[model samples]
Target chain A: MRIFDPHIHMTSRTTDDYEAMHAAGVRAVVEPAFWLGQPRTSPETFYDYFDSLLGWEPYRAAQFGIQHFCTIALNPKEANDPRCLPVLDELPRYLAKDRVVAVGEIGYDSMTKEEDEVLARQLQLAVEHGLPALVHTPHRDKAAGTRRTLDVVRESGIAPELVVLDHLNELTVGMVLDSGCWAGFSVYPKTKMSEDRMVRILREHGLDRVMVNSAADWGSSDPLKTRKTGLAMLADGFTADDVDRVLWRNPVAFYDQSGRLDLDDTDGEPKPDDTSSFEGNSIRRGGE
Target chain B: MPNSGTAPHPSLPLTPEARAWLDTALTEIATAPTTIRTLFPAVRRHCGRAPLPDGRTVDEAVRALLLAALPLRDQALTDEVGALHRYGDPAEQRAVLRALPRLDPEGTGRFLDLVRQTLRGNDNTLIEAALGPYAAAHLPADEYRQAVLKCVFCEIPLARVAGLDDRADAELARMLGDFASERTAAGRPVPEDIAPFLHPFTTSGTTTSGTTIHGTE
Candidate 1:
């Protein structure tokens, strides 16, 4: 079955991950610009990162037959820093880039006033650009963050359907779903929801606008977390159709809203003699 | 010592100042040998090869190399200093500082200064650089073996070399062959983790059944 991981950090993953995901039938991925594990010090760094997302990463993904897409935003954690203003000013240029599916990985981290202001401005930009926003719910004080996120999206006058409240657990899923915005569950290792819990939520929520992602990045997280979640759903007797809708259809529908979800026709069926190396143009020396 | 651009001879006694600088430079070189080695090729590539003034030994060449390489290294280090400050560990910062000579002071001090400033305020990048050696030094034998195995399977660059022992590669090949045989017998989707490493001979075509045949020896 074809699958689409709505959230993943292909930059932090190895080429082996791309091949594995392809082997497991993942046809596409949406990578939202989030803070690298280390804080970035300048707008230049952010611009370079955005360039890689649009340029080099897509080329790398193509080597493994996976379509790569991205979302642009000033992540909440970085918004707290004063030096990040220039980055915020530069967000519009990236928003205009091709294959930017949403303005996101944006939302409250501490529910601070700084976060609120930045989120408000970005939500406005999303409205002006006529694009959807991928909202990242705060890891701490999540209920308050979710509540404030929904409030801002409504106050900003963007359609609720245009927002995706990501990383929802049982505690906050109800408010997100009840408010009519899409709920995203990040099936991660240790910190986020596990596969079993994700399936439980899927069973209860019935997979309307719900989606699952690995949200893997430069940390102790698994890139294959979404596949494990899919396997869990299958083990629980969720039909292939139910699995396909959540893992594939919902993400495609969300990203396609920006009008850039076309996969190369060569990708639909496997091509013979596609023996390309996974390292596409990087000069990193192989280890001894 | 008047007009000699050559480094002090290893056999000849060094002045106290030169001795102190050499000691400090050697310490830094020992800790990050690979980084030093990697830089040597770049420096030589850029600076061109020339024999040292008469009577300089290999040890002196190393010291001279560090002196000549310091400027370029310093520039690269400065560019990454902010990233290091944001992400590096404290011990790594201290080690880097210790390795550099004081470039402002005469002799050893000048070299130390250059090294210090090059690495100064860049602890996070240093820590990441130091991790390979640190992991190689600290990881238990079995864990290191497993990490190397995973790195080989995933194509990640690791400190330890794989395929060093002919027997080891052969044993791994046999185990992989057996696993492929089992998958063929059972008709299961090949595990995603191992699928990348399976050569075309083991898994030839796009068809599900075809994957098993390519992995088989």
Candidate 2:
């Protein structure tokens, strides 16, 4: 039951979450740059946070036996913040780094005019960097927001295959699939798609480019949903092969389009012993 | 065998010969994870204590091979190194420490603590390896200052201390002044390497005598 969650916020989660993730057979994750809970006062804050996504977070994840990759972006929620607008200008430096897999979490939040402009620009950044884009549909008025989000993505001039529309639901998945871009369903607890609902979607949609993630983060979410979805797929009469295609292969095929999803699990280095540190700074804290 | 002159930069581009050794090692390590231990005698034959595992030295080959662990998917490399550090003999312990330059970005505090521990012992070979570029680049300031004094206490030449010249500070000068006093009190000659760093903090003695507190004009 190896899993590659294409959308998760590991920076916001704890090391214990990483342990639980590994215990549930999650091998690797893509932590997309999203809005922090608090408003950032300056772009320097984003720079430091981005550096952690690139450096410290990866180091921390490795200690837990998970290979961590990230998506760099100006998240749609913060797009409305004029103070954070400069982060879009500084996006290129972070995008050039080795671990970045996409220009992402980039799409409509409140579906504002400011959100629209930010989406178009970051999509262009995706094309310029030759990386994929991960689009986040607004939870409020999602049906409408997802529709407007698709229009902006269409106009970005980046190939449709190079984008992944995330936080998708039953109403929006069909249109996103029709657009030829990847569709991501977050099998979260309470609000988003649950495991049973996700299994039904896999049965109906037939698993070509569909992927499932926990999208776990600072919000009320579950990191184990990817695995729970896999279990549901099995209970719903999907074969092991079907589960593999959905949980692992689907995300790989999508992110592999970037030509940078170098997951070392199959590439065959020994597992990392992240229990070490640089100077005195360490990801290897005592206990679980 | 430590390259006391100039520690090899961790990112030193591998040459053709070194590349070949690493290739052979990576392939072999895939099957035998502990082949790193089997490599030391070969290094002794080709290059005694040289950190660059290259050409015919089995040690470098082993080192180059173990580096493959650095990129592993899980905690295997950390566990493997941890296992070696826990059970390995002094030479094996030194080999793991020596490999830190190439294998860094490693997150365990144990490795740094191990390097600090080596400085307190009488083994110059281990101390020299521990003092290489990784220590220079990563050892925290307080630990690094104490590490220098450890070298002086052990009579290990400060020449082998990587980053000694670059990271030296006034605090280190003061610490060295106290170390010099400790040596003089014990009637052991203070190694002259103390002179370069000691001069900054030492002041003249009172009474207008021709003598100075640091014992220099």
Candidate 3:
């Protein structure tokens, strides 16, 4: 069962998490750009973070045998900061990168006027860049936030199919589905949807455009929630093929819209040259 | 120890059409006044990803060409080249590192940090790129020796490392010899290619010069 975690903040996770995720059949992941726990004071900070998402993070993930792709955005919370607005001018350059698959995590946080404007602008950038958008529904007012998110998404004039309203729950799922957009559920440990609940959502939703991710980060979260959900589905009599669809193919289809999802098998350990000088000293032992 | 050959291998030189296209593209970009921030990623679309005769993609070659085309003010050129590598994806980074010898043939040592960064990285391709002609010409002797040893550590062919013959020294040979002994004591067969580098240490009172020793037969 190959799992493609459509949303996981590996920057906040450790190498242990990567190994565990790989051991649990997570072959690929997409780490969306989002605000750190603290507010960033300037756009220069955002540029470095975006560079990491595009450069360092992917390189690190590859070392652990995980193919990493990322979505670039200002993130809703930071969108309110006057200092960070300059990032919008730079978003197109990052958006044009090969590993950047979407304009992401880009919806309302507090649903502020600033968040409103930033979200709309990034959505337009998505449309212009021909990339998909990952819209984050606010945690505080879940129901209202998603509704307003849907309204903003509709008004942005981008195709609903090119949009995914993420961090959804039972209340918002039906509306997002009805809006012709793909639904993303972040299965976390305590707060977000649990594995069994995710399984139940799949059972109800019929696994069309639904994507299950750990959304694991610096907070209290489990990186293998996607795999656990897969197991729960299997226990509930869902076929392996069904698990593959929700876990792998669904995210691939969503990000493939960017025409840049390099799901190639380039994540494995570097193969020793066929004609290396020191054949006895494999790379594994050479370090020692 | 200057690296004079900045052009692609003769066997796989750029097509005249590709060359002309690159000239026009670089001219437009040069006038537009963006360094790597805007133009680096666009190189592939204009240059195409088809393989040249030498097996490197046209995109990679054209990126090098575009980088070398930057205005020749040393500091500005260095800044642009550094930004391109720093912010670039792995492929883009590789293009810049691979082109360093051609871009700075004088061995000015302005780009050692980029080479060092690549050496510190775990990406084997980037490691290979970091050990090219520019690194050979400019990297300090001690660092150069370590970089070569890193190639062995990463299971890369020592033959792929440019300037290996010119840079091979007594200390490097001794290190390879010590490594060979460690493997042999573990009852493992040593790397066949380490023999040339190891030969100087094994033979007493006579060090071979310009022996042309690459690992494969």
Better of 1 and 3 by TM-score: 3
Model 3 bad stretches (over 4 Å): A37-45, A80-85, A265-288, B1-27, B30-37, B44-55, B68-73, B152-155, B171-195, B198-217
lDDT by residue (B1-217, candidate 3, tens digit) is 1113343323434566656666665675566536446667866544556667665777787787677666555787788778778778777888898888777766667888999988887667678778877777777667887888877766777888988787677778888888888878999777677678876544444332433222211
Off by over 4 Å in 1: A266-288, B1-217
What is the Å distance of residue A133 in model 2 from its true position?
A: 0.4
After TM-score superposition, the amount by which residue B202's alpha carbon in candidate 1 deviates from its true location, in angstroms, is: 46
The per-residue C-alpha lDDT of model 3 at residue A182 equals 98
lDDT (tens digit, per residue) of candidate 2 on A1-288 = 888988999989987798898888888899998888888878878876876676557766766678888998988888888988999877865675556789988988788899989999999989988999999988999999888888888888989999889988899999999999989999888997989888877778879889899999899999999999999999989999999999999898988887667677533322542223222222333421
Q: Is candidate 2 or 3 superior in lDDT? A: 3
- Per-candidate TM vs. native? 0.55, 0.62, 0.81
Error of model 3, residue A133, in angstroms = 1.1
Model 3 DockQ vs. reference: 0.27
Report residue A145 deviation for candidate 3 (angstroms): 1.5
Per-residue lDDT over B74-149 for candidate 1, one digit per residue giving the tens place of the 0 to 100 score: 4454433223222222222322332233222222122222232322222222222222333332333334344444
Q: Compared with the true structure, what per-residue lDDT tens digits does model 3 show for residues A1-288?
A: 789999999999977787788788888899999988888999889887987887667766665567889999999998888988999998887887888999998999898999999999999999999999998999999999999999999999999999999999999999999999999999988997888888888888789889888999889999999999999999999999999999998999999998888566634553222112223232224343
For model 3, what is the C-alpha lDDT against the true structure? 0.79
